[model samples]
Target: MEIQLVGITVLWLFLYGYLIVASVDFGAGFFAYYGKITKQDHIINKLISRYLSPVWEVTNVFFVFFFVGIVGFFPDTAYYFGTALLVPGSISLVLLAIRGSFYAFNNYGAKDNNIYMFLYGATGLLIPASLSTALTISEGGFIEKRGDKLVFLAKELFTNPYSWSVVILAIVSVLFISASFLTYYADRAEDQKALELLRGFALFWSLPTILASFLVFVTLRQHNFIHFENIIVRYWWMFVLSLFCFIIASFLIWMRRNYGTAFIFVLFQFFFAFFGYGASHLPYLLYPYVTIYSGYTNETMGIALVIAFILGLLLLIPSIILLMRLFLFDADYVKGKK
Candidate 1:
């Protein structure tokens, strides 16, 4: 395979890491706030807190890697996406800052402030929704080149069915993914109340997750027929595998068995769907405006960056595994004894 393909594949892996880790973190925040407002904080918030304590700080590492890697490997994306993404990117950054600050305040300072909790929960949903615009715009039609200036069609983005579908999918997927993992975590900790509550959430969101995924497909067909056709003709098997994983994961959750294994299926579900989407959208970083061949960095730089990022992923994965072993899954730690 070409170096550019290897580069984007590695970067996609980084983004996929963010999709799982940050989903759990962000979903936990929303669930924490939900528990407080529903007067069930005593039942589930502790479990949420335990998960968040050691995890939130590392949630953005994957995102940072993807962001920098994309720019490093595909320098032209900065030129095309830089102008188009200014508004949405700024909003995502602001929400991220707000989410982090409020998380700190709610956890360490006020401990139960409604305002802080609301910000935490709201940002959890909003950040992903906002960040998803890049993918939406990538399908093309939302950015216009006007005399060397790429104008992002904010109105078109807001009005497009495909864009909203992606946003809805992002939000629901986060909740479903988060709930599935939390259910597994609750079971591991033997917190029956938390387990039951989170299991309910996991089941409740499953239908919406699948439904929203199909909704995106339908809208993508209408929005970008060529890419949609590519997916149907060439990438159908990947999506089929994704659907299979979803079914298996949902079934395991429903049966209340092997919660850890169920969460692994959840990861596979997204793994296939997410990578398939990226794979099908390949060669074009931003439809019509940029292609891998056009936007890629110098061969020397690309080779060096690819090796560096591969090493980074190698280091990052074990670090997370060690973190999980030491804190997240530790017997005393999960039980809050630590």
Candidate 2:
């Protein structure tokens, strides 16, 4: 209920928004290519194209807000994370550019170039894997303050089990989330062929998502015992709820019933787990280097930022809802009747 708490919570919401929206966008790109290679593009590509057409351009808006808000609310993170993130951050940007290029070329010039599809698909996986490095580094041990110089342990990050686990989880979770949503969308469109194919894709990725989640928790115990203990002690219930949501979602998908409900459950699954992990990691933006108390901006600025971000969230959510209503869920548009 402090300003810092409100500020970070708002920022966390933006990041969570990005997690869902961007995951669907990213996963759709990968699935588009996968469908092509598997010769199912004829079945699923229309659904994927329809979903991507209206939303791809806005997928990074939440991310942009979170990145800027974090630095605005917690100036000290810039100092700690700025240099440490340069390589990985640069990689993410490059991958994003490549992905965007594919979108541009496909939309404007070359409709379905295999080379462009490969780049699109590759970036879909690589961008998330690269962006996840920041979260892995946040668990500590990957950044060292030697004198006044902050050195990023790139090799250690590459070799860390927890880092790899998080990357794997990021990719798998994207696939699962995207597939679940697309299955729902295809069903809503009543595209039976696409619906059936996407349903299978959703079921196939469901187990990997849960397994990768457990692997992250297990690896976290060894990687950062303090954070792991905090999760076990203070955050177990949220994770339990997250798992419950996952089970319900997966079951619905498997049963071939209420695909929309299934995706909603998946949303809650990540919502609980994402916010819980964030809440437990609270106070500290990055282990040992910064805490909300130590690193937060002054009261005047913090209050301004908290209010500004809260307003931003208010506006952003409604805009997305309107987008869905107008484009995503519109009776005629969704079914491609118009």
Candidate 3:
């Protein structure tokens, strides 16, 4: 394979890692707060807390790698996206900081302030919505190059249906992914009450997730017809497989059997859908502006970065597996006996 292809594939892998890990983290935050409001926190919050305690600190590792890798691999992205992303990027950073602060406050400081919890839940949805601006802008029309200065059209972005569709999809997908994994976690914990609640959550969010995905497709056709055509023409099979995985996952969850296996199918669903969307969007990191070939880093740097990230992923996955074996899935630890 070409060096650029290898480099981008590595970067995309890092990003995919962030999507799954962060979705669970973010969804847990929202559910934590929701449980508090519903007076159901007594039953579910402990389960959520146990999961977050071990995992939250490391949740951003994948994102950090992907963010750094993007600029490292595609130098031109900074030139195009840097100016356009100022507001959204700043918002994402602030929200992320707030999320981190919530962990500090919840774990080390005060136990539960409604205000703090509210922020936690709100940012869970908002952070992804803000960060999605990069993808929305890449569809073009949201930014214009005027002479040497690039102008990010805030009005256009706000009014665009496609932008909102992506944002909605982000929010719903987070909830669905998080709920599905938590359902499995709850089952592992053998907490029937929490399992029932989270299963309801998983099933409820599944519809919206699928619906939002279709909305994205419809709006993408309107917003970036060329990319939509690429998806339908060349990459349709991946999305069909993604849908099949979604059905299997929801079915198993609905049947209340093989929760672990159901969650695996959920992972597969997103793997196919996320990569399908990404693969279809490719060659252009930012449509009409930066592409893999036009803006890639030098060959030596690209090769080094790919090797470093592949090594990073290799190390990261094992570390997470060890964590699961030691804490998350451990009979004693998972049951709150440890």
* Tens-digit lDDT string for candidate 2 (131-169): 998999888999998898889898999999999999999
Could you tell me how far off, in angstroms, the CA of residue 4 lies in candidate 1 after the best superposition? 0.6
Q: Give the distance in Å from residue 270's predicted Cα in candidate 1 to where it truly belongs.
A: 0.2
> Tens digits of per-residue lDDT for model 1 on 153-257?
889999999999999999999999999999999998999999999999999999999999999999999999989999999999999999999999999999999
Whichever of 1 and 3 has more lDDT, that candidate is: 1
- Give the TM-scores of the predictions, in the order they appear: 0.99, 0.99, 0.99
Which regions of candidate 1 deviate over 4 angstroms? none
RMSD of each: 0.7, 0.8, 0.8
Superposition error at 263 for model 2 (Å)? 0.7
Model 3 TM-score (2 dp): 0.99
C-alpha lDDT score of every prediction, in listed order: 0.94, 0.93, 0.93
Instruction: State the weakest 10-residue window (summed lDDT) of model 1.
Output: 103-112
What is candidate 1's CA lDDT for residue 207?
Answer: 99
Whole-model alpha-carbon lDDT for candidate 2: 0.93
Error of 1 at 250 (Å): 0.6
Candidate 2, superposed: residue stretches over 4 Å from native? none
- Residue range with the least summed lDDT across 10 consecutive positions in model 3: 106-115
